[model samples]
Target: MKLTFWGAARTTTGSFHLLETRGKRIALDCGLFQGRRSEFFERNRDFPCPPADVHATLLSHAHIDHCGNLPNFVAQGFEGNVFGTNATMDLARTLLLDSAYIQEKDTQFVNKIRARKDEPPVNPLYTVEDVEPCLDLFVEIGYYRTFCFAEGFCGRFIEAGHILGSAQVQLDVEQASGAQHRLVFSGDIGRAGRDILRDPEIPGEAQTLIMECTYGNRPTEPIEGLREELRDLVTRVADRGGKIIIPAFSVGRTQDLVYQLSLLFREGALPQIPIYVDSPLSANVTEIFRNHPECFDRETRDLLRKEHNPFGFETLTYIRDVEESKALNELKEPAVIISASGMCEAGRILHHLRNSIHDPKNCVLIVGFQAEHTLGRRIVEKRPKVRIFGEEHPLRAEVKVLNGFSAHADRDELRDYAFRVQTRSGGMLERIFLVHGEKEAGEDLASYLREALGVEVHFPERGDTFEL
Candidate 1:
């Protein structure tokens, strides 16, 4: 079997991998590459190999970075089954459509500037029309149910605990010579004791491992005191009569914050200020989360058993209408506004940052990892000035990052996961390929894993390939 690193190789975004064996080519994850505008367009628009040549696509989750480019891939002629968990398919329906809308709107805005410069108009990567065909190709598979999609290829999905339906993919490939191989792909491994979802499951046995190393360098703060920290931050900002603007992903992170806030409010530990979820996609995704109780953790499931909605509270409102989203800017009282595009590269969060970032009394709460070159990273770095909508704005808002709420596993957790996987393999594991991390993170992880596991660990780069 031949494996190629196509994307998310030494980077935290765009998770695409190609596996070729038994005269069939399969895609691991066809994700959109998120980065600078020029690189983003060129990378996502072009495929290393013909999309039509790929027999099937195995999706990890509904996060845009992991499954965002499926529409474009299908539009480019990939007519094959897109396999994912039932909840993943449902979440992807909402996420992919939102991605298409963003693509069209962003292209239109970019083309307006090009028209003034006499440059040719650019087209969107893909549209809502393109997304429909892709959704039709999705085949829902339940967790741990093994199935064969092509000749000589069979796979199963294990609970990844990252999001509502995130999973780690394990594939068994039989070659023409009748030799079999087990390959496990750790699809964004999640923390063990998280709030909403179950802990990541370890694959039973594997010879080759393809894993993520998103937080390979450092450990995150424990989940224990996170609620108290959030309450303190919110209380401080509200007491100062300033809005606490939170840039969170629409899916996992937003729901996590809401759940925690619900607990705090129930205990009367937080201020009685109004809270708002300002993205339509977040509201829709939250509803999807409610429908997937099988994916919830024991605590969340018990909460639901009591007929309590953890995502909703009396003081909180979900805004969907454009006018209602706009009205947030006119609020005179202190409030908590949680918006989407967690990286602050797009969405209503940009507008919130542009407005509130100039006020020192306000606070910008960052609740997830921010990729390089993103506005969220700039805010985290406390840049003096940041550009939003082609205009520079002073970044005076107090920036507070709460990494405890991250869904991705930290360094210690990742080490423990690798150890468990290796142990489960019964010393038969051959090699480990690390992806979904930056250069330093991958290097740090490679060094640590080599010393601990005493195995061949390679941090592959884009276009790097190896034969097994």
Candidate 2:
């Protein structure tokens, strides 16, 4: 089999890896490349492997970075079955469409500025029409179900406690010599025992193991402690009669915020302020979480059995229509509005921030990890001023970055999962390639995996391939 690292070699956004055997191809994940506008636009707009030759696509989860570029793949000539869990499919239905629309709108916004200066207009990577055709390829399977692709390759998806339906994929390939080779791709390893999702399942054993190390260099403090900090911040903002604007990702971060808000409401920690979820995609994604109660941990399951919906509390409203979404800015009352595009790159979040950033009384709650050079990162750094829609506005609102809400496994958690894989498979795990992290973080994680787990580590460059 031939395996290639096409994306997420030294950074986390785009996640693509290709495996080929028996004259057939299997791509692990087709995710968007998010960074600078021009770079991201060019990278995600095309497929590394000609979509025509690919046999099948296995999606790890439904987050944009992991599943965003699938529509673009379909827009190209790819027409194979897309594999994922039921929740991943559900998320894909909304997430991919939303991503396509964002791409269209973002490109239009950029081209509008260029047009003002007599520059040529840019085209969208894909459109809603492209997304409709892409959704036709989705094939949703359940956990532990063995899915066969091509003639001699079979793979299974186990829960990777990262999000509602994230999975760690294990592949079993049979060569012509009648010997089986095992491989595993840890897709954004999640926390060991997190809320609302079962802990990650062990994927038997493997000779070659590929894992993610997003937070591999940093130790994660317990998320349980963050409630107090969040409560304090919300209370202060409410008392000041200002709105709380939270820019979170539509899939994971949005759900986590709603769960935490439910807890705050139950404990009477937060004031009775109206809450609005402005992204339609998030509203749909939340419903997907509701449908997959089987994925919940025991505590969350028990809570659900008791008729306690942990994601929904009193005083919360989901706004979807354009008119309704715009109306949120008109209300001067103390409220919490959660919008998508976590890093303030696009989506309704920009409108929310543009409306509220100038008010000193408001609080901008940043709950997700922001990359470098993003507007969200600037806010996290508490920049005195920020530009939006070609205008500079004073960053008067207070910014509180809550790191506890991360989905990716931290340093210790990554090591724990790595060792657990070693314990399961009786064979010696050869090499562990760390992906989906910055250069320094990937290097640090590679060092830790070698030292702590006694596994040889390799950080491959883009287009690097290992013949197994």
Candidate 3:
């Protein structure tokens, strides 16, 4: 069998790998490359391989960087089965539609600018029409259950704990003589015992492994520290009679916020104030989470045991409609409103920030990873002013970050997981290919693995291949 690192090899976005075995081909992930518009658009709009020739697709999760290009694959004439867990399918149902909407809207916006510049208008990479066919191709694989695709290959989806339905993929290949080979691909791993998600399921053993190292150079703040910090913010905002706005990712971070708020409210740590979830996608995702009780950790289950609702409380309101969401701006009293698009890039959160930022009393509590050049990072840096909708506004609102709420595993956590795997497998994972991170992070994780586990780690470049 041969494996090719097509995307996310030298960069952090677009996650994809091509696997060839026994006269057939399988794709591990089909994701969009996210970066500068022109570069990102061109890279994602084209496939390195013939899309129609692929036999199957094994999805890790529904994050755009991981599963974003499935529709494009369909658009390019791939009709193979795409596999993920039930929760992945649920999240993809929301994420793919949202992505399609963005793609169409982006094309329209870009075309208008092109018309002004006297340049030819370009078409969207894919649209709702493309998303529909891709949705039809999804076949949900239950966690831990093996499913056969083409000859010489069988795979199972393991819980990755990054978000609802995130998974690590393992493939088993057998020949006619009954000799077997195993490969494990660690999808973006999350911290254990976070919110409603189950712990990342550990792979017992495998001959080869591919892993992610997103936070390889940093150690996350303790979860208890985050809880205390949030409590303090709540007490401060309530005492001052001011509102707090949180811009977080809709999938994992939003759910964590609700669950933690419920926990704090239960412990008498929160004051009586309104909490509004302003994203319709988050509200829908929350419903999907409620449907998967089996994914809950003990702490989340314990909270549910008494309160009967781990993600809901008396003060919480989920706003879905445009009018209802607009009405939130009329709120004059102290409250907390959580919105999506984490980066404060393009969302209703911008409106909230614009309205509340000039007032020193209002707080913008940031609780997710802010990429470089994003508005969220600028807020964290306390830039004097930031541009919003082509206008610059003063940055008077207090910006506080709670790093403990991060979904990805930090360096220490990744090392611990690596050692745990090392001990269990008796050094079976001799070669580890690190992907889905910046070059420095990949290099740092490689050194750590070599120093601690005495294993050879390779940081493959884009289009790099290995024979095993």
TM-score per prediction, in order, is 0.98, 0.95, 0.90
- Looking at candidate 1, the ten consecutive residues that score lowest on lDDT are 105-114
Model 3 lDDT tens row, 292-342: 766678877776678587778888998878689888888899999998668
Candidate 1 lDDT over 51-130, as tens digits, reads: 99999999999899999999889988999999999999999999999988877876777688778889899887788999
lDDT of 2 by residue, 1-468 (tens): 788998888888889999877778899999987777668777886666799899899999988888888878887889999999888899888888888888787778778878898988878777888899888899999989998877788988899998888898888998666678889998987776567888887776788889997777888677777878888888899998999999989988888888888888888878888988898886677678879986789998898789877777778888889899988879899999999898888888988999999998998998777776678988998999997755688999988777788887888888778888888876568778889888878899888778877767898888898887
Best by TM-score: 1
Q: After superposing candidate 2 on the true structure, give the runs of residues whose Cα lies further than 4 Å from its correct spot.
A: 176-178
lDDT of 1 at 164: 92
Model 1 misplaced stretches (Cα beyond 4 Å)? 110-121
Whole-structure CA lDDT of model 1: 0.91
Backbone clash total, candidate 1: 0
Model 1 vs. true fold: TM:
0.98
Prediction 2 global C-alpha lDDT: 0.85
